[model samples]
Target chain A: MSDHVVSRRRLLRTGLGTIAASTVAGCKVLDGLSAPDHRLRHFMERANDLTMAMQRGVLDRDALAQEFAPVDIRQPQRPNGVTDPQDADYVAHRNARFANYRLEVGGLVHRPLSLSLADLRQMPTRRQITRHDCVEGWSCIAEWAGVPLWHVLDRAMVHTSARYVLFHCFDTIERSLSGAIRYYETIDLVDARHPQTLLAWGMNGAPLPVPNGAPLRVRVERQLGYKMAKYVRAIELVDDFSGIGRGRGGYWEDRGYEWYAGI
Target chain B: MSRNTPPGPLVRRHTRVTRVTHWIWALSLFFLLLTGLQIFNAHPVLYWGDQSGFGFDNTVLRIGAVDDRGVVELFGWRAGGMGVLGYSGGAVRAFPPWATIPSGTDLATGRVIHFFFAWVFVVTLLVWAVGALLSGHLVRDLVMDRHHWRGLARDVRDHVRGRFRHAARYGPLQRLSYGLVLFVLFPMMILTGLAMSPGVNAALPWLSEGLGGRQSARTLHFVLAAGLLGFFVVHMVMVVLAGPLNEMRAIVTGWYRADAQEAGDV
Candidate 1:
């Protein structure tokens, strides 16, 4: 009977030994799970790619996000990230009511042009109420009125070499000894030209609030809220975003958020 | 391991599919729970509607730390989730660092780990469903009948008395709990999770609508996770009560000790 108990203890000892061995080895493995270029992180990034591919392939590219009624726009759209910009230039533009503001369209475009806020408001417009899903497991529904993003890109005639559209914002999301990093975002042509992609200038029938991107923001309806670059001042077409902020394609992406937040 | 050949006190209690999926579940759930906590700490509050932000009263739960002070509010009830939740070490994040992946406040890393395991969990669950159907394990073992209900009282009494018997394959309460986990809890977790995805909502609008919007789905997901944790705690206690070695060996090696009369009867 005692020997039987002894055997069980031996089994436990062996089990503990295996766990100890794994922990010793797994310390490095687990600690590096989020580190860039590590094996576990490699798999995680690969999984992110898988998620993006599966969503892109399985779902219709132009499927519209659920649109709620006007009554569904409860309370107000919750502003997030850099809600207010203290940048001297942005303050001057705000002070001037953005009368001199120009939406600069450059990079891989056959006809690089800069248009005033009035010029953009004159383009093709669409209004829809959609939910804003934040990366932090919260959501807000709001009615947005804006010109279709494709209209502007079409006017500029994005060059065939262009593969992605980058949005430059007026808000500085971060600043330190490394200097101020203004907000920016990138989207593939598919999403950039999606029928619902809008350069929104108004929210809930009013001019966009200072807290909610003010003059303009890009609304990529099919993605998380971060994809919508707020406080927009410029749009650039590019074949690659490798030369942009930290080369991750967006301000948040550079800080470790996934570039593709469709989920 | 054949049904009829091993005519002694040893019986094959777990099939290969069951054992493999069980381990997969154990590993995935561990990471899912911890990493899930990490994600939760990012917002640290849950609401029950389509929208949530400042100046609203829809908050169902909130946890935070202020000036090294930790607090938790559920509905209107308040408590200090000092060490394990709101505050840990010097961090003022929800759910302590020890409970999170990366052991620091890294939402991006937590998200990556969460999504990877989420895919693993999803694919494995699909594979398990098909495999379970083909193997008769779902029907033969998991399905409960009048016979199972009849033994409920006796099984309850035996468990309370610490008098385990090898009278039947599984106890009625055990089957019920396991059935709920397999058929109900897990499915709800997946559905709620999918509902929170804006991408999925475009494809499956009815899912979020049925669940009362995306934020509601997030709320349900957290509640369901809590249910799973409850089930795990009860499961562990039962394992210890019924005999840990025998249970562990049954799951790990598919071999469990049974009484002489019960042997070869299965």
Candidate 2:
């Protein structure tokens, strides 16, 4: 019995030693792999890509964001991240009540039309009461009235080469060493042409407030609130966003947030 | 009393697969909780309905603090009640560093760690569930029979009297708790998690709506996690109470020696 107990203890010790050794070795290997950036984050990025693919492949491309009734509009849309713009151009436009404001729809487009807010409102419009989910774990529902982004794209005559629609906002979210950078966001043609996607100019039965990106804002309803870029200035259609603002795609995307904020 | 009778010979209790899966679950769940708490610290308030934010009065629970500035400032909202809601003090900080992953306030890192282990937790659960079902572990061992209910009541009574029976199979309480964890809590956790995702919501809009709303789903996720924590605490206490060495041996090495009297009955 004594011998048996001794042997069992030895076996357990050997097993524990092997496990400890393997753990140390694994740590070393992981440390080696994590040189450039965090290895875990690298894996997370791949996971994010897989999620995007799964979402696109499995779910209906035209699936609309869930809309609520008028009674369901709970909170007055809370302004998030750079509510007011201090830029000279934006100030001039705001001072004039955006009369001189022209939404330049150029880039990979044929017509390259510069439409005014009145022109956008005059075109075919859609109104929706949808929930806006923030990355910070909050939600708000409000009525939004706008022209379908597809209509604007159609009028601008988006070129066949245009694979993505980029929204360049007038609000300067931050001023960096490089220069004063404005907030920008991008979505593929699939989302841009989604029936619910809108270039919203009205909110809660009233003209869009300055605090709520008056005159224009893009509502990519199927995405998180951040993807709905406020303070709309221009719409540029491009094949790739590699050259745009730090290159990860959108302003927040450049700051380590997922480019496809679908969730 | 047959006190002279020899104790039962050691018998296998847990299978190798069961032991491995159990350890994996234990480890992954620990990480998930820590990481989840870290994520929760970013927005330490939970609400019901379609919307929640600054102007909304739909807060159901909140965790925050007040400072020496005499400002009864709150991080998310004033505590729903005293200690029931969350940690509150002179300087309010909901879920301090030790309680959260990465040991600091980092939502991005928290998310990454949480998601990575989330897949681990999911995959291991699937494998264990499938294995359990195929091996009849779910039916033969975990599931309680009608007779077991009578035994369960007796066992509870005995437990209250500080009497414990050494048995080869799990008692009724164990089976019921295990069943709840396997059939209800884990699945609810996974479903509520998926409901939070906009992509998943797009695929199945009814999921979030059925759960009340996105914010409600988040609230449910936190509540379910707390329920699991309760289970964990009870489970640990039970393990300790049942004789840690014996229970640990049974789970780790699959061998358990039943008391002589119980052994003879079996």
Candidate 3:
């Protein structure tokens, strides 16, 4: 027999042998990987990484989300998650109509900022009508007005070591048996520097409503609605999100959703 | 008793590439459907136009239920429409656990399964397209000719009447169904799927726009998936009607027993 035929037969034999072995031990293998404390499956991580890489490699860094005409804003944006936070501090701020509310921006920065709503509005601003796509299979278009996040990062003199921007929110999505936990989200520096990444405080020519994250919210336009942390309380620059909330980068992400929910 | 029956020789029907790709497509599609439904159950309501949520009058379909004390709530809609989807007494379940992967509301697991199989489905489709082109299977087997057009009505009628003749080549109705699936439905599914991705939206903004918007694209994706499911059901029925063992063997082993009457075509 020719060498090619011999090698082909050998390869097929080995392949079949491996398949048989795996099939025999399939239940055990699955059980081990599916243990409660197991890390995210390698295949899931690989898929997410591949998607992230493909998006970053193919698209321009500054590519914008599709902007809509004013007429396209047909319906009011729906409030998801905790619309009204009942926490003591949040309640105090709400009673004052957020007069005492100060957005603290610190961590890995030369100048930390404690900016109020009035302070934020005075800065250079952009208004664009864009669609907010939820992971739950719905969308809404509304005009958002806010200062670009990068401009704030620049004013704060973000250190070169800073790789991510994390948002701390006022709403508590759940108070589980473990403990009370607040909502938080994070984005990489690339998204942080995007022009559409805004600290939005206004919607559709009016101040944001309590149901829709009044006072402030982060708008990473190229991401799904979950990434846009609402009822913003603070912004912190970090080298990594390993120490943040179960180390999964965001609230929903820690609970099983993909961190990079670009879809 | 007759003693002069002739044995027919086995003929090559499906190519090795065709068989492998066909199975891959079948497996991936199965997983995709289960996982896609799991994802859909996260938000069972579908809408049209630009936006949809509470206070939006844009719901095209909803799957919900009524509770004790006649409090009807279809995932937030206070209405009563129960024949197709909603139920009474039991908890409101859009698609039951049996229909979903993980058999629970695990969007993360659903997404992972969906995405992994999506790559498998797309890659297999591309490979099949290339193989079909090179093997002339696209032209010789799938495409209908002028003669086929003339006999299309008769072929459809015969199909409906259960008067199918065992033939070496596919009939016009088969070609038409396969052609529509291969060309129109699959491509629409892929495009609509991509349009829902914000990453893909950045890469190709026009894709989402052409489909009306991300939400509209999502609606289209569900609609097309349902179309594919319909095709699958019909395909399965046809397979059983046409002879399950023979059809299965032809797809699996790439060999089929030629009909004695259709020997002339071969």
Candidate 4:
């Protein structure tokens, strides 16, 4: 028999055996479709990159997320992720009404500074009724008032080498024997500088509620809810994110969510 | 007509582009539907208007479970069907494991696969449309004229009676159905999908707003999927009724062997 020749009996046996094995495993057989090193998964990730690039290229970088009229802000913003994080630092800050709280700004910046809540409130501000799109497919519209992130970045004198802005939050979304992991998120400079991107201090004309990130949160309006890190404690500018959580740029991203949540 | 007559000489039916894109669409739709259900399992409620939360009241559909009961509420009407929707095989999930890709609550994986095939769907549609137009395949085969509909009543009457006019050219009814699906439903699905995207909404705010709301657009997407599923079922029945082997050969090999005497009219 030639090296390339296949016997009919052998082919039938192999095909039947494979079918029987698949039947035995049942649904778990599809687990390999999402396995880390699966070839199909690589294609999917590559397609994600293509989608990201296409969106980035096609959409005007400055185009603002849809802002609704006051009448449209019918409901209070729904709180997601960790509400009332029990971190001691956060509790103390809450106890004092965030009076002594300071949002630390550092990393790849010319000026590193820690500013009080009052400092953020005093910056040039914008109030817009915007829809909060959740990754789970529900949406909520609410009014958010805050200083554009660019203003804070300019004040900190972000370095020219910086490519991404990371938001370090006080809330821990996952806890395990290894230790609690605080939620964090990252956005590119384009989104960081977008007009609607806010380091929000207020919601629906009221002081930010503890249930809704309290004193402050970063809102990347063009992205999904997870991209907007709540309980934002510090901001860091970075050129590379590979050293961050699982190197995927956000807490949820580390667990296989898309880093670019725009879509 | 004689019962024992052989099929006539094979004739080229589906163009290479048509055959290739058709299979690609079949594969993409298969993956997209399964993964899409998985994503829906994340939040299985459908509402109207721009928002959904504690404040929104227009709960059009809600698939959920309690203890051992699975509940599926649609437009205020409710039903219980375990092992299908809501409760499935000892767990609480909107859609059963067998119906979803990864067959679990892996929204992350579901999202990855859904979006991956979604792009494939979009790209293939563009290629198929542009090629069909350039090759005149759209005009010569899929498009219908007044003359094609002249025998419409007879065609439907025959179809309902298990009789078929398995011709080389598409019947007026077939063209109508395909037209509705390819031109209307497909575009609606793509647009509805985009309307739900916050990024696309930024660039085309009117897309979601004009659809009444983002949530409404989501509902429409689901409804349209059901429509596509209906079409697939009817399409399969027609394929089987019209002669599976000939239909399969037409698609797979670009040649169909059918009785020339029967198919000669069209």
Candidate 5:
């Protein structure tokens, strides 16, 4: 027989085998419209169930990742992609060793003020040992000392209308759709008030290094390392984060990172 | 004996569009598996590194430069300028000689291809989904009855014994596997894929946390893709065993004739 003919004959036999299997497989227990599409749907349905369950588990209030010991700190954190802030203003800030650095706290706040580094140093401070979990499959712990962000917000006297605290940093990993140079991150009021959260100025009991967010940075211990905005130059208290980049919460959010980095 | 033949002529089994889509999806999945394995050589699960036994190392050439136009361009350039590797998208390269899959190396090209093809795969799946849902094929063909659940043990016994002759149309195990792949694994892939996207991650911070951050998502993506690959292998093996032509036709044309009297006849 010709190859085509042989193949066709084989097809008939295999088809028969399959049909017998299908019948004994108990598909007739259902109604009887066995088709390839039906099989595909079955797969899709399974995947959907998994996705939704994961979503709920992650977002659910009870689920929490385990915390580690304070002594587990990695000596030197090899900064992931972006190290230094590329913006001219940030470069100028670094040039002066951030002596003249002033963090602008405005936007929906009752008192808009640009507090200098010296002024920030005089505020009430808190220190805590925390870990930095990189999405790159590495983890590092460090002792950080900085003023509580709540203290800064208290001094700024944020408006009651404020719902989101936006951190405007000085580094640019890439560019947002709006062509902004600096990277930004934000947090809701709950995380904003978490005692572990602070505007960290020192790491490992030393003044923050330049590669690290020198001068000042936000330390949100409850979340992943990325949420801890480095080289924080401004804190904008906004009522809504929807007007932000791509209507997502953070700079990286537009690029596909989850808005909640609470690992 | 003639009076025992109560049924009419066997009917045509599969629709044209259905057959085409099935073959296309199957072939695409095959290509995807091969490329995926090669790409994953960067991070081989067991004994994958420079000192490993498999001893294959693939180089990823990432190209990024500030062009004369003052615009920074990113694209994959050939490694050693050997020009053996072809560039597909922005700032990516795939060099052969992969060991186990290298971990912590750039799979940006793999990622891009994976993402691009994912959309195609998803679109195809969606088409199949919509067709099934509209035609009510799924309700009749897929939904397992109590008897099917009861027969699960027997099916397992049959499958293990290489007696899967009855699994042609839609067996309970097959249905269950398909269900999990479609609903559980596919969505996991999509969500994890989306979770890894910096753009998406930045927008949906919750996803990063949910999927254990961007890197974690990448890790999960690889693991899940591996699972799919396993499924594909077994599927192909079954096709081979069940008689390739018959299996292909059944999936394509959706017709098969099985006689009780001619059980063991050639």
Candidate 6:
């Protein structure tokens, strides 16, 4: 090998060596060893600088997103995040083509009920064209049609004590210690009651594709793309977001991302 | 070696002004990163964070003012920070405190500060760029020769293996990072930033075209900031490996002491 190759090989070996050591150490004392604080701080400082620049001159905060004609919605709207459901229950639901799919709505409601996809589709619906602004710096526009979330809550008779609506997704983002398949997101009642908040079953005027949250998903127009959780299975009414994933209130929340991805 | 030849320790690398501007650049870069992330509270990078509310405008409305929406609305197209979005006065008032642009906080203020500091950054950068041209810093310190390009692999290995600190000057990682910061990041910030100006935007619409439009100028700014954040992380990591105090002192004082003496003079 050339000197460069040898040196690089040595460096890669050393990096792997550190990773191995840290992995072993992680098994023993996973909590105490805060990785050296340097990188995160540096990352933070850079994030701050970018904010100052944009805040100062570059951005138009009120700039409206490009609105599209009503007829231009794309067929087969894309599915975001995890495309395939790995959990056995989700797999079963997918296999059965969601024939038995039902959304259990409970918690802080006077009349909690398990409504099937058929039941959901039979209700009154609304359609809106909006843009999906991804945190990864991409945007796509689509028209979503679905049953208004408030209408569903009304049928279930959500109690006055309820303040937030939590959507339990069918996808297992991370396995919890209790061995229960954990999946869910929460939105406050103000947004929950917005006319645009819907349990969408169709995208671009067609039956929602399997990849694009086939049976059901949410369309929270005001928030960024991630907040519109896909493969939704249940909607739980709650008073607070506490006891939710790290209390930041979403799956990605536990992983150091923000909870409210509102644009 | 001839007796009359100056030792490696005596060589002058970066000038004083160049070093000072670099430090300022570093500090401003860091502050921008933190506040930017916090402001992007689309995901609320932290608790109590909100997207679009931490700017100066939002900060001013928190002083117990009631029914100021009319005044806010009256400010009109040129008021607050950005222009109006046609929301009813109720929605305008309902905007969380963080979204209100202070009376003095307009794109103009941002432009003045950005243009002013940017000129400072640019003038210093120009001097450095000229220095690079004169000294062949781009050819020698930056654009690695084809033969040395192959050495990058081993340099990365040595860097990861902890032998990089022993190498003279910055290692391959440091050199590449510095090169990108100076060449890529700085230029992008300047160009995209200038593209946001209406005068500049009209004169050269294509400049902002890559980033969608002038409205997206902020988004591009944030994207570039993200790149800088990545550079900062790697930069600090290398500094830690190289020994922070010694490295910092060398950059600050323009003199490497320690083994910088005759101990391992190349």
Local distance difference test values of all predictions, in order = 0.85, 0.80, 0.80, 0.86, 0.59, 0.58
Best by DockQ: 4
**Candidate 6 per-residue lDDT over residues A1-263, each given as its tens digit:** 59985785577567658966854453234121112233532343243344434532455333322335675343335456777778788889889988999999999999998999899889998877765555433345578889989899999999999988999988866667876546577877866886778899988878787677768988776555677888998889998887886675776544434444442
Q: For every model shown, what is its TM-score relative to the native structure?
A: 0.93, 0.87, 0.87, 0.93, 0.52, 0.45
Q: Which docking class does model 1 fall in? A: medium
Number of the top lDDT candidate? 4
Model 4, residue A202: displacement in angstroms? 0.4
lDDT of 5 by residue, A5-123 (tens): 78877777777688667544432232221121345323422443333344435543333323334544535554554677778888898888888898999999889989888887788
TM-score of 2: 0.87
Kindly list the per-residue Cα lDDT of model 3 for residues B1-266, writing each as its tens digit.
11112424567888888899987988788778877987887887777665675665666667765552232343345765443244432545566555667565677777876887887788888999999999988899899999889989998887676665455677788889999998898889899998988878876899988987777788889889999999999998877666655576678778766566665664
User: iRMS of every model, one decimal?
Assistant: 1.9, 3.7, 3.2, 1.4, 14.0, 16.7
lDDT accuracy of residue B109 in candidate 4: 84
lDDT, residue B93, candidate 4: 90
Q: Report the candidate with higher TM-score, 2 versus 4.
A: 4
Name the regions of candidate 3 deviating beyond 4 angstroms. Answer: A1-41, B1-7, B53-56, B68-84, B264-266
Q: Can you write out model 4's per-residue Cα lDDT over A183-244, one digit (the tens) per residue? A: 99999999999989999999999998999998999888888999998899999999999998
Considering chain A alone, report the TM-score of candidate 5 relative to the true chain A: 0.73
Residue-level lDDT tens digits of model 2 in A50-75: 66787899877668788889988756
DockQ metric for all predictions: 0.63, 0.40, 0.38, 0.67, 0.05, 0.01
Candidate 5 residues B136-251, lDDT tens each? 65665567789779978887887776665432246677767777776688788778766643334333657756775444565677678778878888887876764565566567
Candidate 4 docking classification: medium
**Comparing 2 and 4 on DockQ, the stronger one:** 4
Ranking of all predicted structures according to DockQ, beginning with the best and ending with the worst: 4, 1, 2, 3, 5, 6
Candidate 1 Cα misplacement greater than 4 A, ranges: A1-9, A16-29, B1-8
Over B107-145, each residue of candidate 4 has an lDDT whose tens digit, in order, gives 888888889889999999999999999988888877777
lDDT of 2 by residue, B1-266 (tens): 21223566676788887899998998788778877987887778788866785675677777654432221224343333243224434334467555666555566666666777788888899999899989889898888889888888888886676566677877788889998998899999999998888767776899998999899899999999999999999888877676665677788898977776666443
Question: Which 10-residue span in candidate 5 chain B carries the lowest summed lDDT?
Answer: B46-55
Instruction: List candidate 2 stretches off by more than 4 Å.
Output: A1-36, B1-7, B53-56, B68-92, B257-266
